[model samples]
Target chain A: MKIFELGKAKSPWILHYNTGSCNGCDIELLAVLTPRYDVERFGMLNKGNPKQADILLITGPVTKRCRERLLNLYLQVPEPKVVVAVGTCSCGGGVFRHMYNVENGVERVIPVDVYVPGCAARPQQIIDGVVKALQILREKGRALEVPPHLKKIVRGREGGIDRESLLEDLRRR
Target chain B: MKKIKVNQEICTTIPMGSQHVALPEPVKLVFDTENEVVKRVSFDVSYVHRGIEKSLTTMYDFKKAPYVVGRICGICAIAHSIACTVALERSIGIDGEVPDRVRAVRMIGLELDRLQSHFLINGHLAEVCGYENIFMHLWRCREFILDTADMLFGNRVQYDVVCVGGVNRDIDEKTGTRISEALEEIEESIGFMEEVFTRDKTLVKRLEGLGVVSKDKAFEYGLVGPSARASGVKTDCRIEDDWGMYRDFGLEIITMTEGDALARCLVRVLECFESVRMIREALDSTSPGEEIQLRVRDNPKKDAVCRNEAPRGELFYYIRGTGKKIPGRVKIRTPTFANIPILPHVMIGVRYNDVPPLLMSFDPCLSCTGR
Candidate 1:
């Protein structure tokens, strides 16, 4: 419990990956770190290598060729990590959803904890999403706090929601 | 009789990329060489063909078309937006001129883009010449231009300023003053840059007589913007077409007869100064008014051809609407594609080591070509 508390307080390092976006979303992500937004105050730093990151911040809809590379990179991030899907494109494949050439969104391939929505999400919203993801990380330890009735539905014999089925349903919708 | 003997067996073809340092964006180049001298260069630019034209036809409604089309070229985003809107305006018969403030602000944004892109290309040229100091100085100065752009358009590179009928953003007194001050500072800095560019013997020697495009050859190859102007050809889409504020502003088209890499460099540098002046002029007299944009009335019917002078060169947008929200056919022809035809002609008979600087002389953006 003490170790979990320390890890939560320390704040996780982040890695930014661009699947196949027009440079629009890519530049805005950098703008978040610039002097104006100064996202560093929250202790989030962009790590070039995925092995060192605790959060994977992905922009752009997943393109065909980038999917394998993206998955390989995702696997490289240490376990119990959270993913923040930034921008409308990554959320629901905003403008590029119907391209037929790309995975609909980042969530299609990866488990995303928070979704920040914008044509390209504003920097403030992106920061808020990351902070919210940190809160989610802290709450996982209190799984026992769930009421008896809800616990059965959540931690059912199958142990909570089947993310794959949920994603499939989303895809159909 | 004595006849010159030549062997075709010795000639070799050299391929430079869809991934090469010479081109900033992805495009493949296959060059045939004879004795290490390039003979012919062919372009293979299908790498990033995202089927943008097809998507414009099927995906976007006419109302949503502006934002979608704006994504075609990040470097020339504003130009695409303006051209599409103009084409739409013509098609729907949306008569009555856009208010003076809208016109002026649009001009300011367009010129700011031109300044940033020109400065960036010039910096890249200096980098290719191995003049790291000039490159750094130019880019550092360019930061100011980018910041100004960010202030004006909300984003630096993709400048989301142009809407369907008018502009998305307006310039109030506060921003107008900031822009004027920034322009003055950049204008001041340009003097020092000019000194370095002119006095640096290494830069001058590297660029002088490199990739010379004679006036006749330039015309024959269909060179556009500063590339053609370097060869003393007077052609600029803004000047020729009189799109928005160009006719009112009375722009002085810059031309040079040297037709070398240095001339092209100088033309772009001078154009940067001219852009600052134009922005200043536009800002001073222009006053904000209501209605930055009018609601799009109807979808275009006949094929509409629109063109503009982007920072790189001439950018053309062709759209055909079939009364549906989406366009029937959308075609984009960028300046880099037009300039690519002349690369082999310039490279042929030139030394192998000189290939990089010569290739980058046009400031090629392969993304535009591939798109």
Candidate 2:
């Protein structure tokens, strides 16, 4: 019934979160926005506030210190948000996989829509991941009557997956 | 004089790492504090220490050493590889004169690194200042420099351009012309950034004299790069060693006398200007010639130490080859190590509010420090 949702889905702003891996993926993620690759052509904007973002491009393996903050950030992004785990570290804890401190991959921390793999994940791969995420977002938005349990998971009070509870948590304790 | 005391009974000591909020890498910094103002800060840094030096010795052959060492510092991998390869070449006495074109490409990679690293640290410093907008702006500007690097080299961080003898890729006329145009825009952007940095009264107020390590003390602590230069020391490994194409194509090192966070920031800004000059000179003077790379010797036996002025400070790489598949030993003394030793001394009396900026002033990449 939403007539205007498709236009917004076409141009999804991104919020990049770095957990703990080497900064290689961060640099390559940046390269996607640069003139050469120019992922902005696909209507990607790097937004600072997670609340305003449509896609989350996570570039590192989640760490103990950053896990809570990362989860809080992911929850803040409104419904139909997609998570794109870019880089080997984020997809699966790359070289630092063995480290005791690394909490696991980005998916373990938050649900991931697209997984882009590379030691540092090339700019092209990152762009491809974003495109895939946008497609997933559109598909999810068009879905009809979700079952009751799925509704609770997506928009719920007890499960705490809803936006308002997440916002409340974002405020410093 | 007023003094604060720590109550060991009721106080909970936060064992903040092998990892902390400011660091991506694991390095333990034990804090004994009543609250946020750390009464005492002590740390242990062997967490991520993979015995990289030993690994370097056993894992890589001589030709493969540069790329392996490039993984040393993710941010400054280009400098690590360049310094190591240049040293290895010198040790084996392979006088593969770097063509002006290769020098230009190398300079582009190096300067772009300097631009990105400086902006990154400065943005992080702004975060300490609680100026998030400026932090975003600085980081956004850094993207342009990243794009420039990606265009020149295939990868953004690990360019993998520098081979044993010379640079791997050549700057074709179209790419070169495009890069020249990009540099013009980058310079203008930098000029705009300078205006913003200098005019931001709040930033200056917070950063000014916060972490003032005077010239004499800076020299005493053996700080290098802009950290040393900001203290009025004329010592730079680049000028002193005259390695790489620097001797042939001269460079002017930027320096200052304040030795504070502001002065260090100023040193980086001035150095960007210097880097721009060097890049311009290298580009203008470049002449197309023979192959950019020279054939590596089949098997070589030698031990060499090379030092370069990485964006952080002086990066020293020591390599010993046993004429085997792997290097005998590879030792790295990164800038953070040299700068970190001076931290406890500088932090002795500054207010608790000042510690973060002081840490940022040194541009401590804890990953590089621990690695």
Candidate 3:
């Protein structure tokens, strides 16, 4: 693996966006950053800039106004990123599911990799979800290391390079 | 459109949220500043509006209103549920008939909610002011309060403990003793925090005179909770409203005359002690394993309004029933909604750097405001 991928896997910076949560999961996610949970011990830092974030932690069901902002933030994050939906509201809208203003859940707006389920997810559960997100982040990092079109060329056939297959794959690409 | 002239050469407009690191919820503030001092401010708090009031009247019936309203704001979930349940009970004509044990349990839940919410905002205030160590320490102590709530009510943020007419879960002997033990530890930590907040020169200097709200302005803007009390307004819904047994529990209202950021922080810090005392008194007043919930067969027929003191301020709930399963209307006025109007007033004259801390001092819960 490249040194950049190794460093990215070791430390994942988080960008937290609240679509329209009750402030329960948001605080618990903050609690995970504070002394008791101390997620910083694992080299994870909460970043305010979406451009610098490696993982997007979202809370609340997507509100009509926030839906656009959520998508904008999601698009701004650099690739090899993960999105973790915290709390039941973001998971499937919880109690606010059918509310007129809400879009049901975060998944309706963004692709979520990990869904932490709780009315207001506890700090422990949030930490678990983040840890799961880290694994996905590492897998995504590995996936991005080698381009899909170059796979056949990099891992050639039995004795020599498969130039024909490589050319076909290049043409297809 | 209404237009105003700006001296653009000497002033710059800065927009601070909707999504900010200092704010847990989304709220936007546009500040017009000249020479680092704010000349004016405008705000937008509609980012988190979930139409909870409409849902209460349309989506859910009166019986499920308490749980639905609890989602208005998670930090003050108990306050919303209590106020909603009390209003529902009154509309159903069972206002003062709830058992003493039930009220005690409800008080415990509400006070614990206050303790956690106060800790959260105070720690957040410190963090925004660049005092990260104090923020961590305060939040570290806050875990005890969350654990106690989890032990008593099975969930950390949304307790779902209060229901219509009574409480859903009963506080037994074991949980009561456990709560007492946790409160003792919490009190020790709070004492340490009190010393730090009162004597720490840096924190005091950073917060002392920033965002000063005069007594008249607090009344004029209709500030509630700690923000109003900090300005010597002497208003607390816990005393004015008869929903809880706070009077019997010897609840003392903490007030300060300074009305600055520091005073607001101090008011919340001191109120934590009162919450602790009330929680202890509440546990002592109630016996173990008595009646918890009371059943009611009739739907609400009349309109009733209930008010409760949330950690931030007064939380008001109005419900009108038509003798049907669902209420005809439900209106909720949260504490943050009352407290937010004063922001443009307070932020106008403060330094740009102090904006985040000053805003944090109000403990703005935009979810509550927009919902």
Give the TM-score between model 1's chain B and the true chain B.
0.93
List ranges where model 2 is wrong by over 4 Å: A1-20, A27-85, A89-113, A122-173, B1-28, B34-37, B44-51, B95-101
Q: Cα-based RMSD of the predictions, in order?
A: 10.0, 7.5, 3.9
Q: Give the per-residue lDDT digits (tens) of candidate 1, residues B85-143.
A: 77776666663566778878878878887887777677777877777677667777777
Measured by TM-score, the strongest candidate is: 3
Cα misplacement distance, residue A33 of candidate 3 (Å):
0.9
TM-scores of all predicted structures: 0.74, 0.76, 0.94
Docking class of 3: medium
* Global lDDT of model 1: 0.74
Task: Estimate how well candidate 3 is docked, as a DockQ score.
Answer: 0.77
Error of 2 at A164 (Å): 30
Candidate 3 per-residue C-alpha lDDT over B253-316 given as tens digits, one digit per residue, 9 for 90 to 100: 8999999999998999899999999998888876965667788899999999998899989989
Clashing pairs in 1: B17-B28, B62-B325
Q: What TM value does chain B of candidate 3 have?
A: 0.97
Candidate 1 chain B: worst 10 consecutive residues by lDDT? B1-10
- Provide the clashing-pair count of each candidate structure: 2, 4, 1
